[model samples]
Each structure stands twice: as structure tokens, then as C-alpha cells.
Target: MKQLVFGTLPSRSTDQATVTMGDASESSQHELKGQLLELSQLVEPAEVLHAYAEDYISNTQTWSTAKDKKPRLVLRPTTIESLCRVIKYLHDTGLDYKVRSQGFGSASATDVLISLSAFDDFEFYKEEEYVILGAGGNWRGYYDRMEAAALDWSIVPARTPSIGIGGSTLCSGFSWLSSQYGCVSDPANLLDAHVITTDGRAFWAAEVDPDLMWALRGTETGFAIVTHFKFRARPFPENGKLWAGPILIPRTKVAEVAKGIMSMAEKDKQGEMSDRVAMFLYVMRKELLAFIGATQDMLVVHAYDARGEAAGREEFRWALEMEGAVDQTRGDMTMGEVGRLQEHIGELRGTAEAYWAPICLTGEDEISEDIIKKSFGWWTSMLDEPSSIANYGYLLYELFSCKDNLTGRHSSAWPRPVGYKHMLLLGAGCAPNETKEISDAAKRSIMRGPEAILGKTMKEVDIVPNCIEDYHDVERIYGSHFEKLRQVKTRVDPGDRLRGWIKPSRHESG
Candidate 1:
């Protein structure tokens, strides 16, 4: 291995291993040696094992990038048992390793420190509505199998048809239909997972306990090397549609345009079980336009297109009509018709790649103008500095509420207002390899900017949920329930293999 610098996240460390690829010179090295020796003896030596001694490594940087890492050895284990053997060797040896899902091409959008180039596995059960796919399976491939049966399913697949399904689900994740269905993760579809620990033990991460389920979404990746995932069943829309391109608006009214759309969107959120809708906005040529659509609900799109376009135009006119702007049909489109849509995702992802690479922002979906406005500003700000005209996306501020706003399929906790005036106020930015400076600055801008614009009243009026298990930063978002998640992590990964993303757990040792 070259003189690559690897830091222990949340902290930093130097790899003396760079010298002899040998154990540390003193105590740390001795312990490391013992562990490695023990681990080596347990597995087939590099010379004997057919799957051992192959070179591999995972990095968010492209191979051509200056910061990329080259591995000492790469191994390909075909069966779960072989994987287990491989993991055990690493675990006992205390080696550093990263697991990846092949199609996770986040490098184009975010500063993805890892890639699936060295990892590739895709397996799913077609008829069962349940699939045990490797982190590498592209959602399109997974969808092809599930969609055939008209499956109502959800996975945090990449924005483009080629994006991998793994990293998107576990890290820096979000969703389009999230407003209607909850975070794609809320479907309760992930049934089980196969993982490799840092110390290299192989284990199945699934529990009858709900605590374990919560942890599965939030912290599993760091604790274990996820090889494959089993998902719960979900129903897919009859067909899928894209609401098409942007509804142009002048820059001055961007804030009002956002607020007005969100006000209407909030008003529409009523019944518990309703069709899903998502709205995304972007700024190009000094105009603001939002993209609205669904990945599975193709039926209501045309009606929604007219409805949303009208609503947006009205909001824009009221918000910016005095500015006197021209309305142009940017374009009409579908996700399947990839061309620029894919490129946009690629472009958007490219922005993220340059900024928020390592810190995974898990998300949830709820229909609250407050969350919509705040989140759009928050997500978009991360990339505003990256481009001359910042491209922001993931403005999925559509409402899922129906006629019975206060009442739903299950229940209610928030005080329902007669009509919470709102519409989708937002944007999404995708780029590859976003620097820390850029991501941090964007976070501050959006985190504080929205409150000043919307005031605290809107937050009280809207409900912000996500497409994953996260409760945002509310600490109480899940409301005293996250304890269960910690408990689950402690149980399945007792040794604390989950900390590969960070340092090993304090409670456990390597």
C-alpha cells in the first residue's frame, strides 16, 4: 500500500502499519499482531485459499482521484459461508475494511469516500415480494423484479436508473414518494441483513425485537459490513411518472414562492392513507422551477401536473407577478426517459460528492410546510457554493394528508389547525465530492436562514417526517424511543463491529 493517510473518524490516528504492513512497534502493535496471527491461522493462508489474496479496497474518491486508497489484498468469496470465513479472518486480525454495494454511484453527486467498484452482488426473490439483494444491486434491477408483479415497494435507490440501492438506503439517504409513504424505509420492508464485522465475524442482523429494527436503519453500517439485505413487502403504483421539469420563477420571490406552495401543500395534507406527491425546485438562468412526481404512482400524475402547475403558477404570480416574468415550459419528461433527468441527478449528485461525502444524512418524510421550507433551504445550501448557479433538489415537500387532516389511519398527536396555509417550498442539490468547508457552510445557511424567513409559527403548523428512521435532529423526533435502537445495536453487534465508520466502541475491544 502507498503512504496513504487514514483517519479514525470522530478522532484521528496514524497507521504505523504503513511501514512493514507489520504490527505496531510496541504494545499496540503486539496486540495487533496477536490478533492478526490468530485471524490468519483460522482462515486459509493467502497461498492456499482460492478466494484469498485478491486486491480490493473501497473509497468515495474515484481511482483517478489523488486521495484514493489502494488495497494490499482483495478477496472474492462466492457463498455466504465463504464470506463468513473471510470476515472472521479480518475480524480476528483487526484489519480495516469497507463493504460496498456495486451500483452505489454516489461519487457523481457526493464526496463519496467509498465505491462499489471492488464489490458487486445482486440477488432478490422475485415472486415473494421479498428480496435479499447485495448492497450492490441497482434499484432498477431490483425494481424490474418487483415491478413485474405490480409490487408496492420502496428502496432508497439512486436517483438515476444506475444508482446502487445500498449506501443510499443506509447513509445520506432520502426519498421522492416519502411524503405520501413516509421515508422509503418506513415501509418496514427490510427483513434481514448479512454483515461482516470490523474484526471480521459474520452475523445476521435481524431481530423480532423492534429496538433492533430501529438500529438497523440508523447505525448498522458502521457496526457491521452489510453483505446483503432482506426487505419487507410493499405495494408499487400501477405505473410511475415524473411531473416533468421546472415551473420558472424570478429570483426575488424565491422565498415567497417557496412559502406559498408549502402553504397550499400543507392545507391539502389530510387523510391518513393518501396517494403520495413530491415537489422539487431548482434555479437555472436566474429562474426557480420545481419538479413534482412519483416513482410508482403514475395514475394521478397528469391530474397532478395540471393541479401542481396551476398551484405553482398562482403562487409564483402572487409572489413574483410584480417582478413581471415570462413563464416557459422548461420541458415535459419521465424518469424512464433518462437523458437529462439522469444527467441532472448526476449533476446534482456531483455537487454532493464535492461537499457532504462522509457524513451520511439519514432522512424521514412528513408533510409539513415548516419541514419542507426548512429542509429545502437546508439541503440546497450544501451545494450553493459549489456551482455558479447552485442546483438544489430532493424538495419532496408534497403532502400525503387527505380530507380528514387531523385524523388518519392510525391516530394524531399534533394540534390540527383549521387550515395550515402552505405549498412546497424547496430545492435539491446533487454533486459529487463536496468538500467539508462547503457542506458545513451550507448547513449553517439553511439551518438558520429558514427560521428567519418563515418565523417559528410555520414550524408549529407543519409536520416534518422523513423517508428513513431518523427524526432529524429533534432528539425527541422519535420521542424517547431511540433508546431501543441503542439497545438493539448492543445486542446483535455486541462486540461493537458497527464502529468501523468511527472508532471501535468503548464498551468493546478489537
Candidate 2:
């Protein structure tokens, strides 16, 4: 993976840690290979394989540069007992192991890698009003099963249906339903979880440890290797479909279009805009130069509603009333259909290196056109870069209502600041081999543009709802709950075997 460098900032630290090399002794490689031989005999049929250098090169390549570390030994476990035994053996042997689920980021890299591909379990507990899923399961698979049942359910729609349920849920996943239900791991939807901690102890998160359960929902990677998730599912809307789609905007009218969207969001805080409506605005490079003889960049307005088309139209009247629209794809569609659309586009951008830095805002202040226009301008600058991957990025606006999760029986790991209304996320993407200099500069501009607009330094505003970008302070990511999470981590992972790109608060001491 290409190295990521951040500008000289006071509070933030540079990330330099790479994948661990197991047993760093001079003869460590040979010793580890021998140990694997013993491991294979202990768990027959469960493969403990050693790879050639060529195998390392092939397997190390992942969705993006962020997760490019190669593991020495790849262990594929077929049963829960086998997996637990592997962990205990690694613990007893002092070997560092990392778990992989869909292979999206740096967290998958370790000395001994445990791939959960064989743990692909998915089942619907219709009588229990929940779905039990293996940690390795994908959203697309879950959707297929739900469609077969012909039942409507509430899911924090995966931005692309290909994402693993384990990784997304662990990060306090964002979803299309977030505005209505908070995050996907909003405690209410997370019925229970099965996890294996660093101490070689395995149990359900709820029955054994409540604090561990909170850590599991959001600040997840450092706590345990979650094997199963029993998520509380909700029935689909009465229409069996939700009104949703994206409205394309020509670059010239970005500011004009944004004012209306922000106005609606601000009004919604006061019960003026219907809770049924959730929308986000983004700028993508693919949409640029698509029109004939136009150097126009593209701004997209995506809205989804459960209250029907009339209410949905009224909700986005500002954008609908605009004089010119590049295109609009709006309709009543099933949840599965939405996932497929996301999957199609998501696949296109899968190989590109991506970064996310989201700054949240309060409901009390009005979102001005100046901030919107400035933000878009910052996003447009990257288009000048030579590489399409480096140039392809977006400025996102997403709204979140904390009402439901706030009133629930248990507290969620997702931060709900008083009067917090929405988020301004700056996403920067680049090709795999893009030069570090180009990618770093692009990331800096995207990360700081919003801070400059909001008249706050990066240190003042905390970035929450992270999606693979680990350059910021993790303490800021978890905020006041960092200490509580740290306490839980101390209890569950005393050996510090479980690690990820998202550093734990304890790392601050080093």
C-alpha cells in the first residue's frame, strides 16, 4: 500500500504502524512455519497453510492500498471450536493473529491471519423478529434471503451491498435508515453478538459483558473477534417499497441546489421537514464532462422516503422546483432494488483508495450557501489531478436524528451531541499506484476544507462515523466514551493481541 502522510497539524499524529511480523526473532519465519505444522495436526481438515512469496504477493493485494499488508500464515477454520482452538493456540504460543471479514482495510493484516470465509452463516429467525448472521456474511447475501422471505425489514442500507456486516457494524455503520433509526448498530437493532476476546474466552456480548457490548457496537476492532450478530429486524414499510432515488445537478447550480436542501434539513429540526425524508448531497468525478460540450461537474441529490411520493416530493420541493436538472431517477422501489443499484456503482469504485473525514454540525445554526459552495469548490480542485482514482471523491451531506436511540433502554456507542443535526463528510479517493505526494495533498485539502469553512480548527470539531480513514486521533473518534471503551479493552484484551488501524486509547501512552 502507498504511504499516507498528513500535513503538520498540532493535535493529530502520523500513522506509521504496518502489519506485524510474528515472532521477530532471526529464525522467526522458519519457527512459525514449524508451529503451523503442529497446528494443522491439532485441527485436521482445518487447513494451516504456509505460502510461498508468490502467494504473499497475490493475497496481499486488497480492495485498496489501505489494506495491503501480507500475512505469513493463512488459517481457515471450518468450525467455531476450531476457531477458538486456533486463537488459544496462538495466545499460548505468543503469536499475533488478525481476523479478516470481506478484506476491506488494514485491519486484516497480521502475522497470523484468520480468514472467516468458511463461517458464512446466515439465517432468519422470523419467529424471533431477527436475523442471525455470521461475521463473514455480506449485505448482498442478507438481502437475497430477506427477498426470498418476501418480508420487508429495516436495515441501515449498506452504501454498497457488498460490505461485510461485521466490519460495518463494528464501526457504528451509517445507513439510509440512520435518519429514522440512528446507526445500523444503534443498540435497538443489535440484538446480541457472539465474540472471542483476547483471553481465549468466547461468549455472547450481552449475557457475559454489557460494557463489552457497547465497545462492540462502535469502537469494535480492538475488543474482540465477533463471530455472529443477531440483529433485530423491522418489517418493511406498508407499501412494501420506499420512495427513493438521486437527482443530478449541473455543477453551475450547486450552491442554488444546496440552499434548498439545507433549508429543509434545518426546518426538519423543528418538525417542519418530515422525518420520513432522508437525503444526502455529493459530488463525484464520473459525472464530470458527461454532458455534450459541457465542462460541468456533477452534484447529486439523493433522497429516500417511507411516507410515499407525494410526501417525498414535497420534502424535496426545493430541488424539484429548480429550473434545470441534469437528470433525476426517482421512484417507489424495493429495498433489494436499492441495494443492487448501490452494488453496481460500488463495484466501479471498489479498487480505488478512499478516505473519509466527517465533521458534524448542530441544528441551531443555519447551513449557508457560502459553506456549500466553498465545499464543492474544494472537491472540484482534485479533478485536475492526472489519476482518475485520485480525482474521484465526494463532498457528502447526511442528516441524523438521535431521537430513537436516545430513548432506548441501552446507550449506543454512536455519539449524539446535544442539538447535533447533520454531518459534512469529505471523501478523497485515488488509484492504487498513485504517488503519495498527490494523494496526501488531496487528502489534506478535503480534510481541512470543511474546518476552514466552519471557522473551526480540526482539533475543535471531532470526526465521528469513520469509514477506514485512521489518520485522526481515535480518542476524538470515540470522544467521552473512550475511557469506558478503554476499561472494557483492558478487561477483554490484556495481551493486546487484537489490533487494527484504528488505534486504541491505550496507544496514547506509547
Candidate 3:
């Protein structure tokens, strides 16, 4: 292998492995191993993994069971140039590879994998009110950085701190400020990006390829790999904190809570709710639900706002006044404080298989009482199932309004949020071996209510930016932009090396 220098790290040490090709086909596996080893030497900080290799186990261990794939070669690229070299080599060799960033739903099996954990670079331009970050870091890192610097600004990051910046941003990121400033990936918030096409060409996305930039804002895994992103940050509230907490309602008042949710969403649509405020309704399991103590199940209304606690009460008046209020807590809290306060959700911690399938709704349908009731029943029923208890399967409502004041400077591949009011992210987790069964069961329950009401499968649902699951109807997920995105994919990767990242239509191009 030729020693190449480009990224910050040099090379990783690997222990000898007992090469069992498994289903990789002995001949092809040996050839791929050789090809990857040669390419690995050409890129700084690159590691080529064979099955049973220690590095391969460590690298693939990060993958969620929802789509955990066992690749023949896992390439962990530490720098921008290193990643570019890997892409170029893979494209030239016509070897299929899947790009992984924090490996959320990337469990599909593959022989070649490219990981971006080493590309984490976070920089803040205090005067410019922007942050330049590599694709690898998570929201928690950015928040911690800002806290350390005492910087009073933030960008749109995922609600959870573990989601990678690259995947979140490119997939139309949702943030607390989304309603105010548009999706984080909106051209207005995203200043620019550095990307490498699957063909191995690296350049500034904005300067060299506008269409590619547009396609990336809302799509997953088709066009190219983003190494860095420049994001326009929003100022923190005056107190340097936001007021957030959950408002609990017992089962006795489920109808009232449902009505309040509908009213709040309607008010949001009319531009009545302050953009600073975001809320969602979720049903907790009997264990957590019992805390509020309403003999039957209960719903928890989670809300956040830039305003202080006193104002929060007035803002969430309807929800607060709803009969059967069990318990509530709202206070001004810093990002770091909130992070710590957030319960250490077992499923999100990646201790189990986590699969997310979201359903989106819009217009009057967004407030459908019947849908909410049915969805709640289905969710509660699922929680009562023995598998649900064993697997820690659950779901939640991600209710928030889409920003209407979009600049549209560049086309966003994300489904247009014209009439969409909010979404529901159905999350499920289980032992690795039980992931598929639990995920399917969760979907079955979710479809009975959310899907049936919205008349959209997970494929057609437009929700938050997340790791792509191994579902077959991604074209429906990409919607109107799938064709254009396919064209961009063809332009960037005519060989279709990155096709594994997403499911392909029968006639779709690379």
C-alpha cells in the first residue's frame, strides 16, 4: 500500500485477522481486500477492515441494529482529503460503498463502508455569527463548545445530541428555531458546504455545484459526501436560555388535551403561536405514565420557548388549563442544562436497536381528533404488549410548524412543507436479534393510526432529517425531487458506487 499524506491523522494500526469471507464470495472478498488495502494507503488516516479484524468490529459496532450491515471492508476516513481519496478510489474501482455518519439507520449489509467520525471539526466565527463544522460532530459537541466560549448563538441541530451534523444538515435539519428561521438546511441558514462527489471530485458545493447543494438540503445518501458545513447561527434568548418542560394530562382528560393540541396547531398555522414556541404530544408507557397517576394511560405535552417561565404559562394557557393536569414543570434553562436534564432515554443511548419511522400531516387533518385518539390508543396498546416492554419500543409526536418565510435561494430536496403542520416520529428499540420484529410491529401499530389517517406510508412521510432506513420506497420519501436528485446522482457518481445508501427505483439512475 502506497503511503499518502493529507488528513490530520496518519494511519491506524490493525491486528492480523482470520479472514473468513462469509457470503462475500471468497474470490471477490480477497480481491476487494487487496483493492481496499491499496486505496487505504493512498489516503491519510484510512483503515481497511477484513472480517474478524478488530478495527472492523469497533467501526461496525457503532451502527444501529435497525440497519446494521456487515461490510467486507470498512474505511474510516479522518480528514476531508482522506475522504475524497476514498470516494475517488471506490468510484474508479466500481466498488459499492455506503457512507456512514453516526450510523443511525445505516444497518443495511454491505462489503464496503466509509465512516466520517474522524472529520469532526468545530469552529466558531464570533463576529460573523456563523459556525464552520465538519460533518462528523454531534449537536452536543457544538452546544458544549458554545457553552465553553460563552457564545450566545446556536445553529439548527437535531433534538438529540448524538445525531451527526452532516446527516442532520443535509437531510433538512429540524431545530428549536426551525419555525422562526426555516429548516437548518434551508439555503438561508446554510452558508456553504465542502463536498466530494462519488466520482472523487472535491469542491465547494455552493460555488461549483448549486444543484447538488439544493439536492442535499433534504435528501439522504444519493448525491455526494459532505465534509464541512457553514451555518448561520441564531442568537440565544436574552437570558441565554430557553423555557422548556412537559405538561402532563391524565387519561381522564385525553380528549381535552387532544383538543388543546389541535387548537395550538391551528393557531400556529395562522401565525398566532410565537415562533419561539414548539410543542409535541406523546403518550408515555405505564411506568412513566403512572407518575402522573390517572388510573389509565396519560399524555405528556412537551413544549419549549425562548420566553421565560412566567410567559410560558401564558403561552401554553390552553394546555395548562386543560382539566386533569397531573404535573408540569417549565423553566428557563441553558442548552447545556437542558442536555443534562433530559432523561437518559435508554433507546436513544444506542444500547438497543433504534429504528425511527415518522408520519407527517398537514392542513385541517393535522388537528384531527379522531386521528390523535386512534394514534394514542394504538401507541398505548403497543406499550402494553409484552414485546414492547421487553424491547423498549415507543413513539412520540414531533409537532411544530414549518417556517413560511423561506428565502428559497436554493431548491431544497426536502419535501415542500407547504401544508404540512407537524409530524410523529415512531421510535422502536430491541435486542439486536429482535430489531426487525419489533420494528415491523411498531410500524404495524403506527400505520393503523398515523399512517391510516394521514394516508401516507413511511415512504411518503416528510419528517425530520434522520438516518436513512432500509426501506424500499425512498423515491416516495424524496417525492417530487427524486428525479432531479437522481440526475444529480448520475452527474456526481455515474458508476453508482453510493447506491447502497438509498433504495433505488426500478428505473432510477445512479
Candidate 4:
């Protein structure tokens, strides 16, 4: 395996020509496109798509249409050799470029876009108890492959099927198995990565570069383009069959549900709850229950227990037996089925612009019913706004036990606060026509709920890097790790060629 030598490239030439989308002349743009098309012919199975192509249009679309940008050209490289050559060309010419796998984040590029969708390879090693996965595919595809193999084991990754394995893993994946297995990017789970650096050198980060490997784990995508990942596999609990599903309760039962959640949080704080159990509560419009002919505000409790059906039933008995329960869909489900539970909701992508921020509550403080009520109230306010884009949104409370078993391994680049038992995701969605002022106001309003509950201002609260708005302070998100990550960025991506959610620091290393 080849190794990456840090800080080996000479400084970029002062006279190098680069075309940016905003200032490129028509002739320059035409020349750039011609060059890209010619480069595609250099490698087998490589192709280039212009903006007019249907595939190019669809590939550029993102979950939030607000983040979408039209790139001059899209490059699809199936082999590492092709990918390396393309990247090297782009770097040498100082061309602005970005890499996309699933395009789930707010990051966008306007000059050149490299699509990794062709590298969707999967390989399992039964003897080694590990798997090598390509970066291009989503979690749904990976789960399907696992089920097809009929293997009793699976790697810990994203909870949502539509999420890309590469982006999620690199950003510190939170999963149904996270309570038991730390995070997908934890050293125990993400064993290695195959990365292509800014200089276009391909190498296995784990084989010869521990510093780069540590940076790749949860560094949030500015360091390099990771082509593949090597993850440690673990046996699924109870042969991969878990008891999981949603229990829907009408608005009339909101108080009761809040009490149940408070009780669960208390138990979790006391370490009385099993690590195998994970629960999520969603406060949203009753439209989700339209299939059942119900229309009203709804509170949904999605509960999962890695243990068998009997144990899961007992663990979530409060939710099943709660008064005014409109529906109980909990039952035995395979890991893949559980992961796909939210796929229908995910289909709303591209229809609305969304903003997200995370609130993590540590065990030092007791769970507050006031916080739950306030969060629900915010959701209600959004829906009640007449003819407003915020009418369709959700407040999700993710509750799980905290078990820190990966203490000895290298810490993740994502600064996940220690001892956090509850993670609250406040999301607000609006129509594409909504004015920037209104959208910004709605985004600011969502944070007020958590602020009221924690009795602290937004700056005083620690934000998780997993789901953040574009305006979020990067330094605050990375916390104490920001400086170290900046150093790595300066060393590896000094030219800042790769466009990502986080940009490299402007100050160069000494």
C-alpha cells in the first residue's frame, strides 16, 4: 500500500489559471468542458456529463434544494486509477472542485463536481470479521446486501437508509446500535479507509498513516476524498431480528407521552435501562397517520430493542399500554427493515428546504418535562402559522443509554460531548419560495425551544456536528478539536481544493 507524505507538494503557482463559475467567460467555460471531456477518455469506464444532461441535473440535486448549485461539469470515475488521474488534473490546474456521494449535506460546488456513485462495491471477509464498502452507495443498498448474504453479522452505520455510508461514517454515524457500539467512526468499528489526497495520491490511511486515519474519523469531509471504508463487523443481537416500530398517540395523549419519555430518561440516567434499547419520539403533524385515516397532531414513539420480541415488549410496555394510543406497530423486524422505517419520510427530499441543529443533554442534569413541552409547542407553532412554509416540520428526540467502551481508542475528530444521554434534533422545513428573512427567522426560532429547556443561550450549548445549519459556528461545532483539525487541514489540503461543509483555515502552518 502507498503512503501519503504530509506537506510534500510545492506551493501553488501564482500565475496558474483557474475558472470560477461566477467570473468565467463563455469561451473559458467551453474550454474547461472540452478539457474535462478529453480527460474522461484517458481511463476505462470513466465518463463526463455536462449540465444539460438529465443525469447531471439529478446528480446535482440535494436533500435541501437551497444548497443545490449547478456545476460546469460532472465526472464519474469507476476505478481508482481514473479517479486519481482526474483529481490530479484538477489539482494541478487549480480548478475548483467538490466530491459528492449522496449529497445529503449543505455543501455545494459550482465549478467541477466529482460523483462517486460508480464505486459501489461491497466485500465481506468472514474469517476476518470485517467488510470493505465503497463510498458511492447509500445505507439502504448496504443493508440489502447484508440481508442477501443471510449473515448473522452487520456493521454499525447510519440509522436512516438513504444516508450515504461514507459521509455518515466520516461525520460520526449515530445508529440504532450506537449505544452498544459507540459510533461507526470509532476505531473499533471504522477499521480503515482508502483515501485519495488533494495531490491525487491514493493510499490506505490505516496501513501507514495513523494521523490521517484519526483525522478521517469524524473530521467532516474537508481533509480528502475517501473512496472506500473498512469496518469491523459484529454479530447482530438475536440473529438480526429486533422488536422495533412506531407507536402513534394522538395529541390528546401528549401529556402522557411526555411523562413516559421523562421516565425513560430518568431510568437511562440511572443506568437502569438496557444499552440494547433505543427510542425516538417525533412531534409532528398527524399527516403521517393519513394511511390509517387519522388527522390531528400526533406524537410518535419509535422504540427498538436488540433483544428478542418478548424483551422489547416489556421494555416499551409504557408506550404500548399508554392511554389514547391511536396505533401500535411494534413487532419483530430485521435490521434492514428497522433501518428503512424512515424511508417514506425521506422521500420528501427536494420538496422543501430544511434546517437542522442538535441539542445534547448530559447526565449531570435531570431530564425536564418542561423541555419536552416547549419543543412540542415550537412544533405546534410552526404548523399553526397560516400559509407559512414552516407548516411541515418535526421535532425529534433521540434517547439512548450511554456506554463508553471505546475510551482507549483514538478519539474521533467529531467532538461528541461525553455522557450525553439524549440528543434533540430540531428541524424546520419551508417551501422553496420562502424569503431568506423568513427562513432565517424560522431557523432561529427552533433553537429557542432548547434554550428555554436548558436555561442557557445558544452559545452556551454544545452543538453536535452531525446535523448543523450553514450559519453554525465551525469553531464551536468542533469544540476543542477545532485547532487540531485546522492543523491537519493546513498540512493535507493546504490549497483548499476540495469544497466541503468546513473550509480549511486561512492561516498557514509555520
Give the top-scoring candidate (TM-score).
4
Top of the candidates by lDDT: 4
Per-residue lDDT tens digits for candidate 3, residues 1-510, read 111223564553444422224476766777867775666566543255555555555456554554565665667776666677677777777555678765244523355677776677777777777778778776777778877875567776556566667777766777767766777788878878788887678777888888878877877666778878888766776665678877777766777877777777677758787777777677665565555454755678887777777777787888778777754564858865554444344135436665566665656755577777766665555557667433455657767745643775236777655655477666555555665556576545544544654665555565554545554256666667767776776667666666644323344432
The 0-to-1 C-alpha lDDT of every candidate, in the order given, reads: 0.38, 0.64, 0.64, 0.72
Residue runs of model 1 more than 4 Å from their true location after superposition: 1-79, 102-127, 140-163, 171-173, 196-211, 232-235, 239-245, 253-256, 269-274, 285-343, 347-479, 500-510
Off by over 4 Å in 3: 1-20, 43-59, 62-64, 107-109, 238-240, 288-298, 321-330, 339-355, 384-393, 428-431, 435-443, 446-451, 455-473, 500-510
lDDT of 1 by residue, 428-475 (tens): 222334555554443444334334434432223233321211112322
Predicted structure 1: clash tally = 88
The lDDT, on a scale of 0 to 1, for candidate 2 is 0.64
lDDT value, residue 210 of candidate 4: 73
Point out the higher-scoring one by TM-score: 2 or 4. 4
Relative to the unseen true structure, what is the Cα RMSD of model 1?
11.0
- Model 2 TM-score relative to the real fold: 0.85
Error of 1 at 368 (Å): 8.9
